[model samples]
Target: MKKHQPAYLKSHSDGTLAKKLAAANARLQHCDLCPRRCLVNRQAGEKGFCGAGADLKISSYNAHFGEEPPISGTHGSGTIFFTGCNLRCVFCQNYPISQLGHGQPFTVRELADIMLELKKRKCHNLNLVTGAIYLPQILSALELAIKEGFDLPLVYNCSGYESLDALELLDGIVDIYLPDAKYNDPRMSKKYSQSADYPEINKLALKEMYRQVGDLILDEEGLAVRGLIIRHLVLPENIAGSEQVLEFIAKEISAQTFLSLMAQYHPAHLASNFPELSRRLTKPEYERVVDKLHELELDNGWCQEL
Candidate 1:
């Protein structure tokens, strides 16, 4: 079997990647990168709702094996955890990195070097976590990496509250999109993540991602080459609206859509502030969502054991 060349390589060779990089950089002036539309001029050192500026701040990078099998493979995924996030989820597991912004800033060239280093370590793909805020910098780093023979598949690991414009810039550049379908209820979204428009925005983002990459495709070695993988964490008390999310994926997206039904929702961060979110996800709650997964015939991915 032929080794799968990532889509960004073609985009780079054909000049599409450069165009995207430039377009993404242009957004920094007004900064509508995510759904927040915080018109702050990040290039001029202003911080927005996500607390990110022009500088690229990264919490960590490593070969991670804890992701979905296709993404991690045997060598593990090259994971780059970016600091800060668009959504203020009260139960965010990585609050130190996402909320408190615990990370070191790096120049674009250094960021590119990190990608090269990850490839040298033989990771399956470059998995960028919470990167929507730093899209421009990531694109810049990717351009530099591509020139230096870095060809790992790019994974846009993100919260589903994405802007269509930002995703448009990434159309050809990102090979795999790993987005979370956090909630189907606006009330739940608002109460938990502090984003009232999350459900509506998330659905649109999922649809756009599906349109860009129809279904998950694995290589001969069973590693993902390209696709859209939607993850839904079964929150306690059905606050995540897991059943409705599954139905939408099966009906609106595709029955063939790959899913990661996450059953690891342990209350963290400020989850204790909300009585409904203070406990871990129960076995029954997770099993109910698993049953819905089977009932909807959306059986193309993994479900963790509760």
Candidate 2:
């Protein structure tokens, strides 16, 4: 929303961001950017399931403190909220932006300008939220931003249902992978998120994320400089039991994997139409998930104090 750059942004000496950005952009021709593989002619302004064409549709950009301690740090994580989402979770907290795709349409240049602006603000990282469909634009913007002088550890904030092919394109481009491990059960996915293959997709996608970023990298000040962080929001009625999710994370991925078990669930949008998830998560429900996670002995991450 505002233009600001930090002093460190001007002294960047990591590597050519344009190369990585090019690598990512090459994958967009067929547009297998996500598991959907919509393959629309994005270059010619063809809109896919995500609503927008090749142009970047951004809802909001700001410094956010609601993230994990490391990502948020003291200053805050510079967050760019991209409109439109691949997954349509019935209980989506940001329904207005995701479902509606309500935002300003920005070309790659304008998008890159936002990156430089964030750098000037002394933000911890460039956080891209719900950026699955706009990978091409993001890559182009990163390239432009690098040329104009902007550098910080990049954060790929996304839902876990991502294409391995798309993720492979982002091998070195993303420093921190913030993916939500939602819908452990396919039933909940089909009924709520509209993605019947959520479990399979999310599980496989998370493994790729772990393979790419591995464990989180913290700075000397204990802020996250790079790595993967998994977030799992506890839903009402234990339908998407957070316990099973924690167990799966411990068994499938590394036990040291960073996790955020959130308790901030409330019936939103069309959720009231459904009987089971018509209200907020109970305190006991949140505590039960926490207890199970502890019992599983997963050694890292935080569960918001319910």
Candidate 3:
């Protein structure tokens, strides 16, 4: 059976687009969407540590097969890779896009058009990747897309680094939450993503995501319709980082919730800059995380091999 998809446009007919714009405008004042919380005047053209102002910059947009099975499905996921991420991992794969900030500056209208174009290609949903700095813009575009008959599941494909204040704005918004449970250890997070508090913040953000959508709910066609799907990418070395992440998912969220374990870590962009992450993930490291997954007994979703 097809899962019940929320008609956000019909649900919020009264000034829906306008309200989203206003909210987007409001968020830039304090600017606490991601954990960085630079508190810079984003609206007044002050650049945050994330290197993003109110202007929305997109790196790439089109059908992408890099996502998990459910997200990419058969047709493929319509991914809009945003520019300038909150976390500047030294080993970032798409450093040119995320760090260099490639792509064009788009308004709400252009962003809405991209979403509509993706729906035209039979995309399962609009997968927003690395979009921490541009939540308000994405939401504003979503509002327009909804108004224009773009009715597909919205996928929040994010790194596990986000802010509660920003997430609170997406209360009735996003449908599928595909957040990565990246680093459980604070030292690893700081070394990699430059945030030592990643463990705590990611836990809190995961809780908020679970509260919005409980367990993963798939449609009759096996595509995700709503709910949360937490992803975990195993790194090389003993830094599999599975134990802490698994414990939190099983203990805090439902053990039955969907979990997608990733094994596609390679030396990309600035990986050479960081000695610890200067190479591809070894086979042994991947296998260890897999073994621990079974031990956790939270085998509820997809786990891909490297």
Candidate 4:
């Protein structure tokens, strides 16, 4: 079998990675990396809706085995949890890290070292969680890590809300896209995530991601090399509109698209304030989504045990 060479390695060797790094950094001057498009001068330490400034803030980094099988592999996916989030999901499990900014800052070179360290640990991939807020810095660190011979697959794990231009910058850089499809209804998205345009934005972003890397491809050892993995967390009272999301994925996107239908939803952060979201997902609600997945004949990826 041919050894799996990460996509970014070729981009780095051909000098496109440097060009991409420079372009990503340039956006910081008038940042519009995410869908928020705050246009704040992030390069000058001005804060936006995401609360990130010039420096990169990260909560933690380690090889995490809790991810899907392809990501975790025999060892684990190298997970870096970044601080602050562009999307303000009221029920976010990692609210402290994403909303409260519970982390220390790091220089670009230090961030590069973290990636190299994960590579040395024999991780399957570099899983960047909640990193849409710090794309420019990520590109810089990736450039540095490439120089240090860190050539693991890059996982662009994120909330579904993303800017097409920003994703274009990552065309040849990111190998795996692990994104969420939180809600199919605009009203539900507005109530939960404060973004009514989430469904449209998420669909476009997913299309772009699918274009970059097709369906999930696993190595002989069942590890993800390159692909699109969509996650849908079932919410209470069918607020997430799981059936519609599954319908869209089956029709609009490929029926062969890999999906991770999650059943872990509990009251956290501001979710307790909302009556509909103030409880865990019921068994019936979760099973309904599961039924839709089977009904749609979408037979790829994993599902959590209810």
lDDT of 4: 0.92
Q: Stretches of candidate 1 above 4 Å error?
A: none
Show pairs that collide, candidate 1.
Answer: none
For model 4, the superposed segments whose C-alpha errors exceed 4 Å read none
User: How does candidate 1 fare on TM-score?
Assistant: 0.98
Candidate 3 RMSD to the real structure: 2.0
Q: Backbone collision count in every prediction?
A: 0, 7, 0, 0
Question: Model 3: runs farther than 4 Å from truth?
Answer: 1-3, 14-21
Better of 3 and 4 by TM-score: 4
Candidate 4 least-lDDT 10 residues:
280-289
For model 2, where is the 10-residue window of minimal lDDT? 2-11
lDDT of 1: 0.93
Q: What's model 4's lDDT at 68?
A: 93
Tens-digit lDDT track for model 1 on 149-259?
Answer: 999999999998998998899898888999999999999899889899999999999999989987999998899999999998999999999999999999999999999
> Which digits, one per residue and each the tens of the lDDT, describe model 3 over residues 177-218?
889898888988888778899889999999999998789877
All models: lDDT?
A: 0.93, 0.82, 0.81, 0.92
Predicted structure 1: clash tally: 0
